[model samples]
Each structure stands twice: as structure tokens, then as C-alpha cells.
Target: MMAILIAMVFKLPVDSGERNGFALTVLLAYAVYLSIISENIPSTSVSVCYLSLYLAFVLFLAAMSVVLTIFVLRAHYGTGEIPKLLKILFNCTSRSKVDVEILEKTDVGEYEHEENKLTWQIVAVGMDTVFFYVYVVLISVVTSVLTVAYIIHYRSI
Candidate 1:
């Protein structure tokens, strides 16, 4: 996992096949871990520091991914389009007129607040592609380096 994130940080050009394989491997590893663990946690073996660090990293990654996604969507579509995209993604099972009406009304009311919040963020992160990539690369590198150091120091001993 650290290696893969480091590769991304360095802009290492992996072919799609290798990327797909790596993604598959990570997913399978997680699936196996969930299946074997049964309960929520080890309850005895995992150190608190490691568990907390891992959770923090996961949360950080999720947040970064969300912001990056919003940037991508912003680039391709205007602020007005997001509500439609969100509706499509979130309420795919819409089957009634009332639902559609409520969604539209909510979108109209929320657009102003969203627009104000989104403008600065999009400008801050969307200054240039380089800046966006740099943010991701820097965070990934920092986290991966810590994780690598921890593993080498504790596990390799």
C-alpha cells in the first residue's frame, strides 16, 4: 500500500494492467482481512498507535479523494450541474413526482450556500493541475513514509 501510494507521489507511470492488478490485490487483501477478522478488531494484538494512525490515514485519504473528485467534476461541469450529478448518484431509485419535486426544491435552496463555499475551494485547489497533484503527492508521500518507517522499525526487527 505504501509502495503504491509512493509510486503515485513520484508520478511513476504504471501501465493500466499493473495499476488494475495492484488495485485488485489491495481489494482482495482487504476482503480477506475483513472475513478473517470476524469481529470489528483484533481486540488484543493491534497497538493503539497503529490502529489510530491507520484510521487517520484512511480518513485523510477519503477526504482527499472527495475533494479531488469535486475538482474533477467542477472542471467538467459548472456549479449548477453538481446538483444534477448528485441527484443522479445519490437518488438513483427515484420513482415518484414528490421525490423529484423535493430534490429540485432542495437543490435550488442549497445552491446559493454551495456556490459561496465552493468558489473559494475550487479556486484554492483549482489554481493549476500541478498544485492539485502536488497536494495529493505531498500528503501521500508523508503518510506512506511514516507507515514505511513504522513497519521497518517495528516489524522488521
Candidate 2:
């Protein structure tokens, strides 16, 4: 089903940049869904089939977006090591730009710098998780409301 496909696509091994790209794609898809619905609506009554389709479409979009957002959050915050296959697929080489001599010269300083960087990364991951959950909840609520309204309208007709 569409939901399964969306979930699998989100789960695909990729770097942070690629994951962000997928998130943007989800947003674009939701926009397209909205445009399609707006174009179909008119002052006159709409068909049951059309309403039903709209409900299904919005629900699908909502589900995809919600699941995708969760995956994004996990990718950003989860402490799991990246798989070797994923590193290869993403073309990630374990090469550091820092000079070995410089690292050796400032061993204590380098450790402090690393600790600071880790703290900042944790804070960033926390913020991203909160933002993603808020976005997903808002979109899901809006889509659910629209779907319910459409169902009520269809029933009344």
C-alpha cells in the first residue's frame, strides 16, 4: 500500500542532507494534494466519489507525512551507529580534514573542543525532535478534520 511504500522510502539509508530532501518532498506532496482539492471544489455540490477520493487522498498524505517526520526525528536523535553498507551507499569516507600534528599538539584542548561540540549536537537534536513532532501533529490534525468533514458531507448527501 501507499503507506508501506512511504515508510520504506523514509527508512532508506542516507545522509542527513538526503533525509532533509525526503522531508521536503513530503511537504511538496502535501502541497500538491491541497492544490488538487482546491481545484476540484466549486460552489456547486460535488460527487460522492470525488469526496471519497479526497478523503482517501488526504488521509494518505497525512499518514505519509507523520511517518516520515518520525523517521526524520529518529535519524537525527538516535544514537545507533550508521551501518557499514549505508556508509558505502552514501559514499561516506572516514577521512578527517584536521591535521594529525595539530591534534597531537593540543590534546587537552582538542578534547575540550570535542566535548563542546557534542553538547551542541545534543541540543540541536533535541530541538529538531520537538519541531518535527509539532509539525507532524499540526498536519495530522488538519488532515483528520478535513477528512471527517468530507465524510459528514458525503453522508448527508
Candidate 3:
């Protein structure tokens, strides 16, 4: 997904100001990978530091992605036509009344805010739910074995 988004930025030939948007998107991709490694901080003191840094990085990446998305949208379709675009998006849904309400409620700021919020919510909840159901349920009985090994090795001096 990050690759696809970055490709799109290049495809659009983003302006000088917007070009950093693409770079930042790529950087965020790396940040996520780095975060995964940092998640294993075993030392109690550095653990909090690593966790705090990871959270900050995640938030920064999220904000960067939102800004990049807005820049992409503006470059792709100009803000003037967003109402019509939103109307089309709304109409495509099954509920007409709900669609009108959506269209009515979405200006650039609101649209971006809601869109980013929903995207993150969906990703966080979806991954967590899937992990719990698909992985945790299947492996729950054996988790104690793995947990004990990890604690014995990583949590011990």
C-alpha cells in the first residue's frame, strides 16, 4: 500500500512542496518496520523510551499520510470539484438519505478528518480483530509455552 501510494505521488509529478509528501510516505513505511523491532525493548528503562519514540513516530507518520492524501486529492481533482466528487461518492452508497447527510457534512477539513480517522480506526480494529480470532484462537492453548520461553530468554539477565 505504501509503495502504491508513493508510486501515485511520482505518477502525479507532485510539485516541489508536495514532493516531500512522497518522500515522507516512503519514510513512514520504514518507520513502521523500525517500530516493530523497537517493540521488543527488553530493558525496563529503555523500553519506555523506545515505546514513546515509536508512538511519536506513528503519530507523525499518520499526520504526514493525511497531509499527503489531501495534497494528492487536490492535485488530482482540485478542491473546487470536491463537492461533486463527494456527492458521487455518497450516491454510490446504498442509503440515499445517509448519502446526502455524508455529502452535507463533508467539507475539505471535515472530509480529511473523518476519512483519516476512519481509515486508522478500520486498520487498527480490523488487524486486531483478525489477529485475535485467526491467530490467537488457534494458538491460545500453546501461547503459554511460547510466552514462558520468551520471558525466560528476553526478560532474564
Among these predictions, the greatest TM-score belongs to 2
lDDT by residue (tens digit), candidate 1, 1-157 = 5323422421322222243344344445444544454456666855555544554554454444445544444443454433545444333432233234334766767754553333322332232234336656765776677778788878877
Best by lDDT: 2
1-157 per-residue lDDT for model 3 (tens digits): 3323433433333344565565566667656755775676565663344334434544454445555545444544343333555444433542333334445766866665564232322222232233224333333433455457657767787
Show model 3 residue runs off by greater than 4 Å: 1-12, 15-28, 50-55, 79-157
Clashing pairs in 3: none
Compose the digit string of candidate 2's lDDT tens values, residues 88-155. 53333221222232346567766666632322223333334444455455546655777788788779
Greater TM-score among 1 and 2 belongs to 2
- lDDT, candidates in the order shown: 0.44, 0.49, 0.44
Among all windows of 10 consecutive residues in model 2, the one with the lowest summed lDDT is 93-102
Question: TM-score order of candidates, best first?
Answer: 2, 1, 3
Q: Give the TM-score of candidate 3.
A: 0.27
How far off is residue 14 in model 2, in Å? 9.7
lDDT winner between candidates 1 and 2:
2
Candidate 2: the clashing residue pairs are: none
Ranking by lDDT: 2, 3, 1
